[model samples]
Target: MPDNARRPGTDSTDRVDRTDRAALRADCASCFGLCCVALTLTRSADFAINKEAGKPCRNLQEDFRCGIHTDLRTQGFPGCTVYDCFGAGQKVSRETFDGQDWRQAPQTAQQMFQVFPVMRQLHELLWYLTEALSLDAAHPLHGEIRRGLDETDRLTRLPADAFTDLDVAAHRDDVAGLLLRTSELVRATVPRRKKRDHRGADLIGARLKGADLRGADLRGAYLIAADLTGADLRLADLIGADFRDAQLSGADLTGSLFLTQAQLNAARGDAATKLPSSLSRPTHWDR
Candidate 1:
């Protein structure tokens, strides 16, 4: 199966990451290279080489860095740039064993490696929960998000020993429910106009290819079957816009604010469609 479920942090330098990345960096560098030693990878579309968990790659530098840092994409290792440790690697390295490189304490190496995935999963939860709080238009979800944030924070603060023993998957279910509700609340804010006020609205398939949807407020608009190929959707406020069965092939939604993945999944598009990074092209369009 394709690793379609990407852990958050695509735009690692995006606003959400920038806000707290300094703190993460501080905590991570003190790490004893846990991520380098603990994770495993298979040669796949994203990863160019395979690595065993706990065994550092040959290209790993003396400072526990990737030697191909600058030319990741050019050097056929784009996956490294795309992957975020979610702070787990650092936490394990520093807090788990007092920053002692597992190489020195060979007996603890196996246990540290075993706990790496668990901490990675918890850190991923923190990433999602943190992002959920930053959406300004998601006021309705503010309270629930705070709770999730608090819980995520608590888990992230666990010392290395407890972190290693964490049950990551079981904890995810609790947070997933809150995240789903948060998505609903955010999307619900998009208002449906009474009289199809789709002026400048970027319809996905209604013969609107190459149309202009600037300054349009398409709250809950049923855009299914609208042809929005090559449409200009920059600065469009598409709150709760329905994209079910919409033909958005070649459409540009990059600057369209408030567009959610759930909305995109409900819509129809093909391989010919150009989507925002936040959203994925529907699989039916895959060759």
Candidate 2:
């Protein structure tokens, strides 16, 4: 169960089910600025300069807020604006470390840094699992999805040492298997080819405007800066597709499988971008 979760075995526990899902969204207000300190950033199109892991970002304030929060994209930190930890930062700060601050508790800094990433992977899995359970086409796999969600949620509550020793990759592999099955089950309902496999394709800067990509398996495909304007992406499997800077104006993503909020945030969408009811239009999208 999550922080305020009630008894889980009751028929009337649907309220907690929604809260459990909401907990996976990034909650910066409850975090300790973990991402700014624990993740490495290199000077590139996204970041202004280089910063190593375990070092606080120069723009991180004493109150754990970004110094230039509002102007991150204009200040060459567009990467920060797209990154989401899936609420792992607050879980580590409030649950694992019991509200300890790395700046004040210098002795706890190293362990906290190590645990943050581990918790992040677990939370990301939780995000996928929660999404899987909501798919009506995946009704057959709801039992397995719930079990996976519960297990992943429990793992997020582990202590610092346990997190440091956790085999997150192995866990991710197991969850991936489940998600793949869920994707297959859901996509089968759409009238596309049995296998629209485009996994890991180098589609960067591809001019795919108004293409019919419905029910395509684009898992992990490099779609960076691809022109997908007005594409028919209904029921497409976009589990790990990189949509950074991709043009999605007038694209239809209704019933898309495994699409995440982070991916949508990275892409450029407009008022004409048709999204599933589960996902909202990116705030930066042209209205």
Candidate 3:
């Protein structure tokens, strides 16, 4: 399972308010260790061992807590630390299943596992839609965003059997179109001369230290290990941009669109890294 750890909210200067995002965050204590058992863990730099789907990790305790929770990175499970189900675990574990754990009803284990990923995707859409609705620049599309949010939220509450045949990809496509429109509206606030488009660009290990990337379209960009130190990413559309091992020390990400904590967790940063008030400074950052 991804850590999805919570931090205190800072001053508000971003798109979405923290209070509105409380339910979007993962609450592992209220969950049934669904991520630990339902997801697969391939042996890699991110994982210490190979774990098949639906099998509890060896470190998972009887109480649904990770035995090595405090030292997952040192234990070669860094990948687990960067994952966030957007609060889908507890929704599926408690509300969907009515607090009946898989252990208590072994017959429902596989069904619950199947519904989890679907719910996670829905929750992720909710996260994005919520953020989109909060953007003043996207005000013209607020009605549409609200409809999308309500429909996505409704899909999340569907019965377990409904998920088996749900066409989630189609729904995601519909939501993605709306988000693209929202991105266009928000990024238009930046001057045309300052806008850059790097959508789906391969920027792995690129040296962008002190680069000016304001209002850039970086959606789905591969920024793995990129030297982005001191880069100005304000108002950049960072949805789906992979920040794995990216250096963000002294970088400014205030008002960046669709940036998530999981991406920040995978990157390296320092005290000088400026983030939106909605995000927390990763504890692993250099002090």
Candidate 4:
């Protein structure tokens, strides 16, 4: 069976434990063409062409798989390669819609497209909440993380219209505050060091190899194509950090705050890169 095939007793509203990583990871085999159709892209460095929302990409297959899945980067679809739906595509496809596909039931296509992005945001929060709950140093804030995780999960299970109408940004703000506290709590254990504030700094293509970035505030910083090889990123606040094409070989992110899979996938890494147990090494990383 596929990785995300429906397990017995698992339904749309079922609440799994926060530590269940399988539920939080993207299960492409279980997803319909949600990402290919629901998302809009503009022609830029990230995308080779432009596409409007609710329209299927030319490369999307009738079976709901990308035609250029193996060569997306080479085929000028690098953005697609870096995108992660955080398991929302599968949940919205299989559980929410009960395996009803947009192609078969075109009437529901509009609603499905609208709900996909909302559910994607909720699931992203679930990823962060789940990881927060796993931090031993953040035990005191486990209650907050659990509450956020429950609420986020509940949001994902809502009906399509309800999910679309949700004020996801407001919920994200609430969860962001909690995550900030969680970061502070975890980083407190690290020995006192100079606090580096690189929030929103543009370090694109800059050389940061082997730099000490411990306890740095890198929120929203653009590090695209930055050479971060062997950098010490322990206890750094990496919320919204752009790491696309950054080199992470031998870099240590053991306790980095708010690092997402999408960010990791966008960057280049190797087996020597150190990461928190909650996050997996990107498959593209060189072994």
What is the lDDT of every predicted structure here? Answer: 0.61, 0.84, 0.88, 0.85
Pitting candidate 1 against candidate 2, the one with the higher lDDT is 2
On lDDT, the stronger of 2 and 4 is: 4
Put down candidate 4 lDDT per residue, 88-180, tens digits, no spaces.
Answer: 899989878888999899998998998888888888888888888988999999888888887887777676768756899999999999998
On a 0 to 100 scale, what is the lDDT of residue 207 in model 2?
97
RMSD of each: 10.8, 2.8, 5.5, 2.7
Which of the predicted structures, 1 or 2, would earn the higher TM-score when compared with the native? 2
TM-scores of the models, in the order given: 0.58, 0.91, 0.92, 0.91
Residue 111's lDDT within candidate 4 is: 89
Poorest stretch of ten by lDDT in candidate 3:
1-10
Question: Model 3 segments beyond 4 Å from truth?
Answer: 1-19
lDDT order of candidates, top first: 3, 4, 2, 1
C-alpha lDDT of residue 275 in model 3: 97
Worst 10 residues of 1 by lDDT: 1-10
Which stretches of model 4 miss by more than 4 angstroms?
A: 1-14
Specify the highest-lDDT model's number: 3
